[model samples]
Target: MNYNESLEKLLSLTDSERVSGRGQHTRRYDLTRMRVLLDELGNPHLNTPTVHITGTKGKGSTAALIASVLSSQGYKPGLFTSPHLHTFRERINFDGEPITADEFAALIEDIWPVLTSINHDGSHGFITTFELLTAMAFLHFERKKAGFQIVEVGLGGSLDSTNVVQPQVCVFTSISLDHTAILGDTEEKIARDKSGIIKDGCVVVTSPQQPQVMNVIAQACQDHGTAFVQSSEECTCTLSSADLYGQNFDIVAPWGEFSFRTPLLGAHQLENATTALVTLQVLNELGFTVTSDSFARGFRSVQWPGRLEVLSEDPLLIIDGAHNPHSIGKLKEALHDYFQFRRVVYVLGFSSDKNISAMIQELPYDNAEVVVTRSRHPRSASVETLASEFSRLGVSVKQLDTVNEAVQYAMDLAQPDDLIAVTGSLFVVAEAREFLLNIPPELYPSLDAGMPIR
Candidate 1:
């Protein structure tokens, strides 16, 4: 099968991301299905050592950090994250690059027989598109004989398909209220769901969390009899300086102290970087080699798209995928702290399943104008819905039919010195990023163009 055809067939399966509200997703998140599917494929999830990362906001960034450092040290590391910005291939990265299109299609073809057989038998329930992709990642990593697998959880930790692996280090990065309807309504409940990634033998590392969230994670570690590494308490990270281009920071760990730099913006990245440092330290102690030089280089070069990424300076354009309310607040804080501008124009959109009301409450109503819009995804929140919220807050808001139009409108409304921030969701950011960066669409043949790639 061709790449587009393979993608279409895979996406045609049951997808939880497109399913909104409560109860629906909770019913489908059974890890036994994943285990059974993996068993049929010889349990490739167990072949390589791993670092399994979970939490609401920074899981992807933390995973990218560890994978980059490991790759810098001459290890063939595979990184698996969710919600691709452009192509589905971005979900599975080798070293610093995504798996090639040819590889993806071929892998699907190779596994088609076993997959069809299980589907035909209907023993483990209908496998989801995410389950299939997770299996693909594990199998691909095994075939490549990867030195390590750095896995980011797709959803809540315990029942997430990626939780099958007993990792060398389990990481939780900045647990906050997100996916509230499906995971839980409270931070404590969300933290408990995330802490399920803490397997008995693996060391657990976490960023600084709210007191209640911390208590939940700590209790989970105790239940597993696992060693818990609190990055905030165990490591002191001091930000020396930050600018639009990059930031420099220093981390003092119990093992040693080292300086680091990353082009990624936002003060929150300091926490994610620190969390990665602690996880790498644990990985190193667990018989993996990580030199300070490699760590320094990796931190300097890692790229995680759609998070405080400055695309241009002429209009002072910035794009961030602050999908949830807590993240939107962080994006607002970062803009105020890191950049200087006369006026700001926001091109915003978000997924429908999120806490949209709380997210709207986080908008920067002062010195900002919002151009509300929707992405191609079926779950994209309506511009009317977003505009109503903005209007109620007594903010200047306008509606556009598409992300491209919204970005253009924001740019037109802003002077060259003013900033235009495209955010709210990665699906929105992906569309805007494609237009601004002159990236051609990674199109699938005859597929629902916006089939909720998360």
Candidate 2:
């Protein structure tokens, strides 16, 4: 079968095994099963130098930054992230390019038989869908002989499938209250889970976090005998020209200083940049030697999608995948700082578990017209429920059953000088961009087209 066809089959398998493979309803967090599976596959995750990134807000962006830096240093970098916006291939990439269909199918096929044995062994439980994807990425990176691999944790780092790798540098972006049902309700609790990626003797890099969260990471580093570096105390990022297109910033860290301009937005990205800079510094300290020129090249060429992505100029169309409250708060700040419009029209949808009401409340536009919609996901929140929540905020709200309808409604309501921002969930932004903005589904790889991932 072809790439798309194969991927569809793979997804079907995941759906079929959802009752056993997915941990959505359970509190199952065991690495033994995945560890056994990885051991069976020869532990491909151990074959490359790695940087493991974890956090609530900026882990994805930090991973992109670190990978870009590695690429600039003349290293064939491997990047494994999650929840692809358009295509499944987006989850695994090398040197900033998605893995080819042929390679993906071959890799998955090679692992399928062994994976079945491990899954059916009953020694532990079944392998999760994410665990299989992690295995695929590791195997591909090993086969390609990548120099460095950037792996973003799927959820709480402690038991995340990607945590199987022993990373040279462990980076934690800003921690916030999210995934309370799984990670816990308190900031300290979440921080402790995120700090799980901090391995013994690995260099830990992080931005200044809440005092409570910082304590948790500091304690973890101490327990592991790891050197912990904080961005606010040990690294500084000065951002300028952070507009709709991209950003220019200077990252000064304990190891050295470098300046770079990236195709990402928001001052919040500076924290992500700081984390990456420290990771690069640690890489150099570990004999990687990523020089100043390489630093400039890497960041300048770096691209992420969806985060404040400018889709149009006439009506000022912007799309942000701010599914969580913390990310939505950052989106609000970016919008307020960068652009001004006569009117704002928000195209919003979210998953059922997300605090959609809190997101709408925190978004910058109270006076902006709101169009509530449902993303093409099994867990999407109903448009009417979201619309009613927005109504309580006294915002003029309209409910559209689908993302496409919401996009059309916003576009029709928007004037030449007005702005239409699509957000709430990555799925919503992806579906809207694909169907409304005419992005071919196959080519639309990531939500973060030219932004930082964390």
Q: Model 2 compared with the native: what TM-score?
A: 0.92
lDDT over C-alpha atoms for residue 363 of model 1: 68
Question: What digit string (tens of lDDT, one per residue) describes model 1 on residues 198-219?
Answer: 8989999989999999999999
Off by over 4 Å in 2: 12-27, 253-257, 364-366, 442-454
The Cα local distance difference test for each model comes to 0.86, 0.80
> Residue 326 CA error for candidate 1 (Å)?
0.7
User: Which digits, one per residue and each the tens of the lDDT, describe model 2 over residues 136-242?
Assistant: 89999998999889999999899888888888988888889888988999999999888888889799988878889989999999999999887678777887566
> What lDDT is obtained when candidate 2 is compared to the true structure?
0.80
Alpha carbon lDDT at 398, candidate 1: 89
Q: Distance from true position, residue 354, model 1, in Å?
A: 1.6
Residue 255 alpha-carbon offset, candidate 1, angstroms: 2.4
Worst 10 residues of 1 by lDDT: 19-28
Cα-based RMSD of the predictions, in order? 2.1, 4.2
